[model samples]
Target: MSDANGGFRPRLRALDRRQGLAFMAALAERLRPNYLLYAEASEQGDPAALRVIHDLIWEALLVKEARIDFERQAEKLAEMEPPAEDESFGARRALEAVMALAACLDSLRGEAPEAALEVSELSRSGVQAFIELTEGEEDAQRLAALIRQHPLMDDEYDFQAAVLEAVEAPLDRGALKELRRLGRNGGVSNLGLTLD
Candidate 1:
């Protein structure tokens, strides 16, 4: 199950619907703090609103009887998108977080069959952007090389692989909770940011 050249999508497609949704939800959960941090700093967007949608995703996976209004959730998620004109790195990362969550919701609604892969790529892109911003390297080729070799990027790939492995196996409520815990990564984001 290599992630090379978007190879993981076919593997994701092999999973059952619930498994795929679980995979996306886990990645989205990991990304939640990125948006929350941005929202807090910018004093825009409702952090609690985003949290509600994330909570709903986990609940839906954990409880068989739980139901989510995907369309309404998508509408709510759209409102959280950062303005395109705000091109700060934080804004970009926050936007990716929102989009990843939206992809998760879309997958649940059967609108985005590749939601898991999209979330995976978004997470990696966020890490790459962070590395490029912090490294301060103007050379595109060197920066690209650095990003491929960075520890954060390695962790991102490893984390996604672990999540996929978890979902590929049999899952129950307890396993799902464990997966969420793994995604949480002890209150850390993919870029190693922690919510204060």
Candidate 2:
């Protein structure tokens, strides 16, 4: 089906199915920018962030589905034991982090926003490069060293401060007053808001 802009859209059913390994790999490369955009939007508190969030979730889930299909195919065709789960990949922790991010979004949208959002470094480029390096070399030890060197696992970024910083840059006198009004109406979060 084509959208109003005449772009051909994939059918819903087609999108719902598990993609092949090759297809998933291609899609991941294509959609990675969307993940980066999502991060930017999140930091900016852009209302469009929700749409990007949905795309990120869909893309990540499809990758997971492809992996499951590949595992099943390998077991059936090769008559070999299924590949062992690699805890070093930290897939579960990554999912948890995403879930936490979603929850933070919800909290921000609620009447009583949280005082602060604790977030880890969400460097999409770093993650993609790490995946490529690990997959290419098939070396978990090397991946661990990279992770340690890059400090990719650290939750050092502050979400609320980022959002405020992004939004404040373009605020004029009127917008600044409006922001102050809203800030007064809604108690500030423990997340420090610096007005320069």
Candidate 3:
């Protein structure tokens, strides 16, 4: 379907339906930024102190959808620990962290409307990449590479893919487990915000 502007809309994939929670979690991680932006230059404060207020404004106005997604992931993971094979326990925890990043993004977005607009444009474009997955491996790889190149870091897709692959086929259990854990902390898990 096309939007009012005639831009092509994305249809959610079968994979998205089967792993909606995972998709949202991945998105939240993707839209959220890494490291706080400097609030202001200050000699009174340490030359280097982590301040995320700038990033907060970027998230709220820009990555609201992804933030909402991350919040859901975090909420869902609150109760369980060490999930069973089907439960994806490790992925759940990583989703929680994605929520944290979204929270920070929301805060940043409130402060800077212009920057927020730019970020939102990037996010909408990113979703188009998600839509491209239905085409084929070439499309998927292109999207994945685009995602990897994106300023926001989140490795959930890579992690989830590895897990899914292992679940679907025979893979090294140890390697699979490691990838699952790494997915949570990996570069892709930066929670949807640009490092810059």
Off by over 4 Å in 2: 1-32, 35-101, 109-118, 121-135, 150-196
Please, what are the lDDT tens digits per residue for candidate 1 over residues 47-143? 8999899899888888878877889999988998888889988899899889888887887787887777778888988999899889999999999
Report the C-alpha lDDT of model 2 over 82-166, residue by residue, as the tens digit.
1235233333222332333343333223321321222212233334354454547457787655544543222112222232332
The parts of candidate 1 lying over 4 Å away from their true place are 1-9
lDDT of each: 0.86, 0.31, 0.33
User: Going through the candidates in order, what is the number of backbone clashes in each?
Assistant: 0, 0, 24
When sorted by TM-score, best at the front, the candidate numbers are 1, 2, 3
RMSD of each: 2.2, 20.4, 16.7
Model 3 over residues 62-173: C-alpha lDDT tens digits?
Answer: 3335344434432333332122342332233332333333433433333322322233233444444443433344666777666555433233333334333433333243
Model 1 steric clash pairs: none
Of 1 and 2, the candidate ahead on TM-score is: 1
- Which of the two, 2 or 3, has more lDDT? 3
Could you estimate the TM-score for every candidate? 0.92, 0.24, 0.24
